[model samples]
Target: MKKLIKYGNENSQYGELYLHDTNCIGTVCLFHGGFWTMPHDLHQFDNVAHELLNLGFCVWNIEYRRIGETNHKWRDVFDDATKAINELNNIKNIYNHVNINNVFVVGHSAGGHLAIWLNSQDLKIDVKKFIGLSPILDLEIAYYKNAGDGSVEKLLHGNPNEFPERYLFGSPIKLKRKNSSELIIHGNMDDYVPIKWSKLYHEKIRKFTDISHLIELEACGHMDFIDSKSNVFDVLKSNIR
Candidate 1:
């Protein structure tokens, strides 16, 4: 069963923890992607949470403030993610059956970008592995390409040339860490956030550490990564370990 929990003051910034009756392996921190805007929220990850629970994982599906919301900033989204992770780590006292050391992260689309960026941050809890499903790893490229109808600019508050430091701080490509074990999965036919981003990210990270890998799924699209019935589901199931 899944239990609703609040990680932050706002109702939008909360998490759903999927707990098993027994034999829980670890936790999977889920972040949903909708170009970092308000149109999409954590509800999209309900199926993902259930699936992860069935796979013996305690899923912490999180929701955060988006750009469309009142007075919400791009940095707040990142801060919300950090707070969620820290809150989950503290939950061991309440839910002692779950393993904390095996905590992993699975983020799709824009959520994937957040997952990668969050992994780069110096958090109290160390993520065991980060799985990004079609992440927008390069903010600079996303800004130039104008992905999601200028979603990059909307999130960063300006274009790359206008806010180079913001782009530098938010881009996962620029924030790649040497100690992280990152697996990026992209669909070959993804029109949004194209597979090339993951390819370039893997290429860049592999130079510093051999722990990063990029997998391209045949006949998959942008949403296939989150579809429980898709073949990519098998890939996600296997990689959660």
Candidate 2:
């Protein structure tokens, strides 16, 4: 059954946990991407959650504070993400059947950036693998290109030149660690987030660690990565195991 649980004080900071009734292999955390803005939330991952459950994995669909919300700050989003994962680890106490280890994170667009960033952090909970679907991995590039209608500036409250430390703290490209494996998938036709971002990021990270990989989908667009019926979903499923 799917259950909603709070991991933070604010209403926006919560997650929906999908617990498989039998033979659950591990946990998968889903993060939705809306360019760090208010228009997106956990609801975007509903279909993905069910599909993960069917694949013998429990799902945690997370929601974090975004810009345009009260007391919203970019760091708060990171804090909320950390809280959600920590809560997921403790969820095994409630369900008893849920596995705390072998946790995988799947993120889309902006959320993919966050997943990569989280994987790089020094957190108490360990993430086994990170899957980024069309992530905005480079904040400096996204800032210079004015991607997402100035979403990066809005989140950082300034350009990368003005807030280099913030960009260093937030950008997955800057924060990537060699501890966990990461697979980045991008559509060749993605107009929202160009395929080059994933390719460049993969190239950069691969130089330091061999665990990073990139997969480019032909004729696929930005949103196709999240579509369960799409070929991208098959690619994602094949990698999850």
What lDDT does the true structure give each of the candidates?
Answer: 0.86, 0.87
Q: What is the lDDT of residue 111 in candidate 1?
A: 93
> Taking the tens digit of each residue's C-alpha lDDT, what string does model 2 give over 1-241?
9898888789798889998876489899998999989878878878878888988998989999998898777688888877888887578878888876778988999999888888787777778898899999989999999999999999988997788999998888887585888889889999999998888888888888898889889999999877888788999999987
What tens digits encode model 1's per-residue C-alpha lDDT throughout 92-203?
Answer: 7788876778989889998999888887888888788988999999999998998999989999788878889999999888975848688999999999988988898898
74: Cα error in model 2, Å: 2.5
Over the full model, what C-alpha lDDT does candidate 2 score relative to the true structure?
0.87
Candidate 1 vs. truth: CA RMSD?
A: 1.1
> lDDT at 236 for candidate 1?
87
Q: Give the least accurate 10-residue stretch of model 2, judged by summed lDDT.
A: 81-90
Cα-based lDDT at residue 209, candidate 2: 87
